[model samples]
Target: MNLIETTYQLNQKAKHIAKVVSVDNATMTNIQLRAGEDIVEHSSKNDAFIIVRKGKIRFIVEGEPVVVTPENMLHMIPLEKHDLHAIEDTDLILIQIKP
Candidate 1:
């Protein structure tokens, strides 16, 4: 088994960080965002889901706002257009699978 640490280990200096922690049958990415930062609007290239490790993020999906907190996880289908805004300092893991 391989263990990967989150923002604590990988994102100490940047406002936004995206790293592919694993890639075999699927890809696992560690993403971090500092308070007030946002990921530019884009489309999911593969089937994906986000596991929130800390703080909150607002997902704007096709203009609809969906707030996700530490208690929540968000999933998206391939090619879905979306944007992510950090409501607070946040950390998450994005698992994407090719379909």
Candidate 2:
């Protein structure tokens, strides 16, 4: 059996990004951001599923605003443009599936 630790420290006034898993078809990344942090507009080449584990984030996807929280997730198709703004100290798991 294999196990991976994905815990991250919260409340820090900094942005932390780490790749926790990588395989033939997919990858998982952990992103932790302090309140007021923002990820500038960008696009992904692969399909993406973002799981919000803690706090909240405001996502601008294709110019549309979407509020994501631990209550729900966000998904984007390949080449979709998006940006993220941390509404509070946030932690998220980003999964990308390659074609």
Highest lDDT against the true fold, candidate: 2
Residue-wise C-alpha lDDT for candidate 2, range 11-51, written one tens digit per residue? 44488999999999999999999989999999989999999
Global lDDT of each candidate: 0.81, 0.93
For candidate 2, the TM-score is 0.94
**TM-score against truth, every candidate:** 0.86, 0.94
As a whole number from 0 to 100, the lDDT of residue 53 in candidate 1 is 86
Model 2 residue 51 lDDT score: 96
Runs with alpha carbons beyond 4 Å of true place in candidate 1? 7-11
Which residue pairs in candidate 2 collide? Answer: none
Global CA lDDT computed for model 1: 0.81
Off by over 4 Å in 2: 11-13
| C-alpha lDDT of residue 18 in model 2 | 93
